[model samples]
Target: MQLAAIREARAAKVAEARRILATAETEKRSLNPAEQSAFDKFKAEITSLEADEQRATFMEDCERRALGDPVGDRSFSAVQRQVNVVEVIRAQMEGRSLSGAAAEFAQETERRTGRKAQGVFVPLSAIESRAVNTTSTAPELVPTIHRADQYIEPFRNSLLARRLGVRVLSGLSGNLSIPKHGTGTTVGWVAENAALPTGDMSFDGVTLAPKHAGGITEQSRQLIMQSSPDIEQLVRDDLSFMLAQAIDSALIKGGGTNEPVGVLSTSGIQTASLATLSWQNVLAMLQKLDIVNASAANIVASTKAKAKLAGTLKAAGIAGYILEGGKVGDLPAYFSNQVAEKTGTPNTGRVIAGDWSQVMLGIWSEVDILVNPYAEGAYSKGNVLIRAMATVDAAVRHPEAFVVADDLAI
Candidate 1:
């Protein structure tokens, strides 16, 4: 009898442990040992299954009150079902004598699957960002300005029209050529037999006169004449507006300052000037004014300059340099090759190239300094318009004298 009681006690303990595991598995898919310990402690306090039901009901009532809901009784019923399933499984695991129904259910599950079911929980990192300062003064709200004249809304409408016209003209021109005939076809026979050939069969000058006369007609001349002023104005205005915006933004971000005072100079190669660049001078100028990130561009230039300037800048811990030209394509091959080599490696820095307008736009948009070897004739009035479009809001810090901004707003 004493031995039987000991076996019953051990079975009870095992059953209780299984019940605790089941509750934890239902609440969370998995628990670490610490979390499992908390569940076991709670389970140990319950004197009977009725006590467990009462505790669960009370907890359900509390949750319903906290959530301000009317379904506390239904929630408790669900919790009871979960508790019952866990307790029954625990009892079977502990070697207790199960009821016929419980024994049959356990046997059926064991027959279907030899392994016990388990739950798993995956861990994740918490994402975070800088908190907003509630105590700071409110930012001043700027009113949105709407243009009064729809027709004169910069290049808005004209740009689309110009693009459409170009597309149509290109499509028409594409269809103007004659289609190729298949093999073994002579030019004279193909011209005569072709379905859509311009019939000019006779080789005599008198017979060809009519076809030549048609080419010289006013209608033919009108086709070329029709495409002049509107197209020209459209391109001019679009370029003008874009450049203006780039320069304006650059000036604003670069602290609304005038161009730096110095003779706008250029090196046939940026590497050639690397030795002469004074870091102290550049840093002093940067400190005196608000210049955005300059190190990247400087570093790129240094790299392109190779040992000549890169080593100096790297030793001084200077970070960036700028290249001047209209397009990335326009940069000298030697400089570009050097830049490509250093990209993504440890001694990397930003390299930029553009005409004044493009570089300036890049500066304003990227909040970086515009770098380029200065050139005067590189931006004539017409080309300046194009450059301005390219750089719109960036500061045009080129040394050359050009109208950087439109005094009269378009």
Candidate 2:
């Protein structure tokens, strides 16, 4: 059978197994002896079908290899070994306990890395085929449109804390306490019986708890079989981009219930009266920061506000402050979609300017991924679901070091 047909047959087998399991669980009780035995039998058949699909795919890859080479000189044994490596790598990803050939591969990997194979990413140096053609005819050199390899987030540059400095902490959850010097001690040339005043130092307590950020998606078995590597990469990038956007949103305007507290939303941060992006207001916003932080401070605004500011510079009466290389005066300006452009009824916008180094972001846990081959959502479609999760938080170390211009006219 063709590779696609084999994949479809395996998927049909999986669907059958799921149907049996579902029917047996309709009463929400433990399966009887006969039902248990039948379910086990179905599971064994599904396993056998999966193995058959793998073999069929390997054989097709070998055929492609033979057709691509002018001499048709590729050993079946070599192709089989490459296929085994790929399968072992996939088993490692699925968090299954490897045995047989897969177990030997894991052992060799551990010997080389000095750590368990499960914790490390074992790269597949060689695969059976690199170029895949769906047509039955002999292969030809054809240009292919590949997606952008390296993923870049739209809001990455505007994440102040992430750009300037971030405190990477380990653990599932924790609290941070930062010491504050409230008042200076009294300095005096004491007389015979004088007493000196005591210096006052206080600490601010911040609770850091990791809240789960995750998503799941399903794809048909045929789709997965068609372009496994490309589909895997696409799924991974999508998950990463989704998390990046989430973190950016929380850092800009989080409610503080479970996520990071945003600088604009946090109490007691300095605010400049910037009803509009006039040259005067812009200067005032820069001046609002302390001299020490002013040199290091940067501005983050929405794309809409940036356009408005560009127009403000061209206005006839206004003293245009030239924006050189995405900067206004000495401060570097950045734009993000996360910033609000139209907040209130009066059509207000927001502008954030600050020493971003004072902002701290805590990443609590590494991303965890799980694959469920028998998910109900994909059961009828004969597909599987991939889920990924992460945990993180953000905090401004010193609110005074940052400034926000809120309710500004757009």
Which candidate ranks first by TM-score, i.e. highest? 2
- Cα lDDT, all candidates: 0.27, 0.56
The TM-score, computed over Cα atoms with residue i paired to residue i, of candidate 1 is: 0.14
Query: Candidate 2 — worst ten consecutive residues by lDDT sum?
Result: 127-136
For model 2, residues 251-290, the per-residue Cα lDDT tens digits are 7777656777867777767888767556777776666664
Pairs in steric clash, model 2: none
Tell me how far the alpha carbon of residue 154 in candidate 2 is from the true structure, in angstroms, after superposition: 11
Candidate 1 structure quality by residue, lDDT tens digits, 238-335? 33343332222222223223321111122121211112344553333322211221111112222334333333442255454322232111123123
lDDT value, candidate 1, whole model: 0.27
